[model samples]
Target: MSTKLKSVPNDFDSIEVQPLSDIIGAEIRGVDLSKDLSPAALDAVHQVWLQHSVIVLRDQRLSDGDLVRFSKHFGVLDFGPNMAWQPEANRDHPEIFVISNVVENGNPIGFLGDTEVDWHTDLCHTDLPPKASTLYAMEIPTDGSGNTGYMNMYTLLDALPDDLRIRLDGLQLKHEDAHTLQGELRYGLNEGDLKTIEDAPGPVHPLIRTHPETGRKCLYLGRQWNGEHRATFVDGMSRAESDALLDEIWTVARKEDCAWYHEWQAGDFVMWDNRCVMHRRGPFPSEMRRIMHRTQIRDTAKPF
Candidate 1:
């Protein structure tokens, strides 16, 4: 898509807001996230995020407490998935989720180690998924590893084929909670927990969900693993039928026209709306080390 200029909000008069792409991302300059933002400035950032879906602030040096404090301006904090296994520094802050490839004492310092994470929303398996997610870069590989990409779901929905749009009107999907995005079973789960995708335990949500705030409808394909027993599929449909439908949806959703990628910098901070966007990470070399701290904003209600 081509780039276009958007008028900055009145509260953004002191900050420099630059659009990263036509559809998805914006970079906000001249703001110190470590210090508390004025109410007007915080609202200005929120407005930019609502318009762009994702916002990046460069050269931000934030501690775990600073990250939590800034993220709370958006909404209530949600506990990270690895709260039980947090590193020493993060043990005091359960809201901080560590994403890293570093191994210390023969144990990973964080999750999603060095592997490419495919397209998916954050915690969609839950009945009430997060409204937004934030990530702060601490250490990054020198060889340009771990670039993150984001897709604009609203634009994707608007450009959907008529047949597919019609098919999605009333369809609901089961977001499988049995496995992680990397196709591994979650902690304390076992093979006996789920026998088939048909009977898997998870949240049932509309295939196309309306954003509670924006009131815009968008496709919500939680995640589909490449295996005979997939994680997410259309609810109540036969396995074959659901697979065929999902295959069609993926063909359109995976198009690069509405996507933007961000290369990580040591002091970069990124926050994205989980309600109307999907994201993925590129795989990095195993020998490289990348450390990132993340936080999620809790949603007040379940998706309709």
Candidate 2:
């Protein structure tokens, strides 16, 4: 008998995969998340997600059931503790985290303020920040506004000068939930809401985080509103200096080529890796209506 085993057939040759943009995102056509996915198909999806930090699937036509089924294909899902928009969904599905501006009574709550949302990763203050997040647009504003922007941190790191990259190696930074709370309260968080936020413990992480899957180092300086905690430095710099340095970092990171903007459409599902990317929501008219459902994937690894 021959020592070599018989050749096995590959089933993924039929799937259609295409990149959305050269630098960041991809669109995987012809895969139905509603149906049972073969191991090969799941592997293909995983591969693309790793390659392109963000993936957009147009016309997914996913219902709540479809969304839940699709999310399970990735890893364990995380329903955030803080309430945002849909409380009923939270109660029914522990896997899906809701992000919306609508109240329980079907009234539209406009943006918390007219100001812009700064650059930040989701759930960074938690012990296990979300690995990925998926947002489905149910309704988009009529005006050509409310664009969601994303930055490819991996590309940003690649563009950095060698000296800066070397300096950021093994640096840590203090991440607090206080700023998020302040934003909420500034927008009118009630006493009960404030209590819930206070109970959640804050976490610290490396200023330059290493992607567990890709093994790439990324700038992890998120949006800061309150300046209370100590700095976690990788280059042995003081807090004030670190803050100034971060401003310089943002100047490079927020360049047009390093980022992509997505104009929302109904039934579009947008997913991005929180570990290696930062996102921001654009300003939209307060009078117009916009609603979106978000589900965040749980991070299996502990916070660095």
Candidate 3:
């Protein structure tokens, strides 16, 4: 067990944080995120979040304001690139990025449009990527669809092959200017640095980043692929060499051993550390509906 998680005082309030998976998630019980919390309660929640990279709060009925306030407890918030993609109904609240596939009156209601969102870190293309992100599921499909999966990069990096670790050491990668999780150009990005996949807007991040808080190292491959194209590249390596290397990395990174898939429920709120975890959404039926509101916590420290 991580010392970071143990030795909790018996007087730690009425909080209970239970492990959801062997590696990645924890279910936070006995707190309603929609309301303001006491200082002690807030601290406990924050610590639990750090100890477990991803924490799921079930049955949360949070409004945009509640979500933002709850998210701000950890860090400043960011209206990431996804904000611009929100529909008119959600435009007034840029802090809330609407994720849905529902259509009404001939227009769609939100973003992510019923497709498989490949593995990625939110705002990885930005110079200052957000530190964390929280999503409140409003409505989910009746059938098991749109399951979001999270990978424990800390464990992933720790277990990496010696040869691969040595190769990735001291290396950097330019994460693709993320237009979308599906790699489509985001709204109003065509004329900017994110014009094409080859020459798009993205931030250069260390291939192996040391966590600012924990000082733990993790593989930070931010969205390695966009469709069939290489959305990222190992700096200083030839295109063919980078691609070959990335292919091998993906072979290990995408393995199920390091992942946990979340089956969504209405009012289930999940917040994950963007710094040490990469997440993806499974494909869903276009006809079925899935609505979620997401908020991001701004980054404070850069990856080393």
Candidate 4:
């Protein structure tokens, strides 16, 4: 029996997907962010996203609703953590969170001061972590000091030695409540017993989780230190042993080769798989204005 190849649709020619790096990060050209995407365009985006994990679209503008609407196409929209919000962001659009260093009339507009934000997945402290996050730049420093960096956990796990991979086969991470992305503490939280997984301030998930859609495993590591509680140890491992192991893993996982950093422009929008990538930001001058709006997508499938 002979099978004929499926023909590519004519509309698919309108979109372009280009890899930004060898492992992660791709740029999608020829798509407008301000307008609604056609069904064919959406499917093209979804497929490219699954293959690249991180996709960037440039030179387009989107409002709070537009960003939220675009995010909903991929998964359940997560309005983000319930906490205090900037008056501007809270007035009508609580679903969209601001990430700016701009202050107006003695009030700071957003979170993350002009300092380096350590790498961590969005909402890892919660029982259900968001599957992905979308960040749209409104204004960014001309100097490009606040470039965002992403680490591909799929390759990070694959590059691990066979022994380390085997050893981490079934370990679960005890994630603790760090401050919110806006860098605020969760209400009624305390820094207590991080040594025990059950006692940690937040949820515990498998260190190596299989992606529900792709079935590919990625290393699910969060930040080391942040707020009252941090991920202190692996489940069923002593503090000393866990610390030693994490140090070794981070040594390789945090390497420069494992990451791709994106410098922001006013109209750049990036969507990344939070479940399979850990991201951080570089420090910028405090005097400069930098603004970004982010929407996170909630998880439906449990990490195995």
Best candidate, lDDT: 1
Clashes of 4: 0
Q: Top TM-score: which candidate number?
A: 1
lDDT of 1 by residue, 1-304 (tens): 3232333344344677788887789998878899887787887789878888999999998989999999999899987766344444536788988899898888788888888888889999989999999999999989987899999999888878898889889899988888888888877878786787656678899989999888888888787554234578788888889899888878877776778999899999999999999999988999998999999999998988
Model 2, 121: alpha-carbon shift in Å? 0.6
Model 4, global lDDT:
0.78
The C-alpha RMSD of each candidate to the native structure, in angstroms, is: 3.0, 6.8, 3.5, 4.4
For model 1 the TM-score comes to 0.91
Clashes of each: 0, 2, 1, 0
lDDT by residue for model 2 (177-260), tens: 544523543344343543432243366678777889888777776554333232222245665677666666666776757888
Clashing pairs in 4: none
lDDT of each: 0.85, 0.67, 0.81, 0.78
- lDDT per residue for candidate 4 within 85-157, as digits (tens), equals 4333445666677788898887777767688887788777788888989999999998869999999999999
Question: Candidate 1 at 152: error in angstroms?
Answer: 0.7
Tens digits of per-residue lDDT, candidate 3, 1-304, equal 3222333344344677788889899888777887778777777778788888999999988888899888888888876345333444545566777788988777776777887888888778778888998999999999998999999999888777889888888988987775665756666765466554446767789988988877788888888444356678777887788888888788888786899998999999999999999999988988898999898888887778
- lDDT, candidate 4, at 253: 71
lDDT (0-100) at residue 41 of candidate 2?
71
| Candidate 3 to truth, TM | 0.88
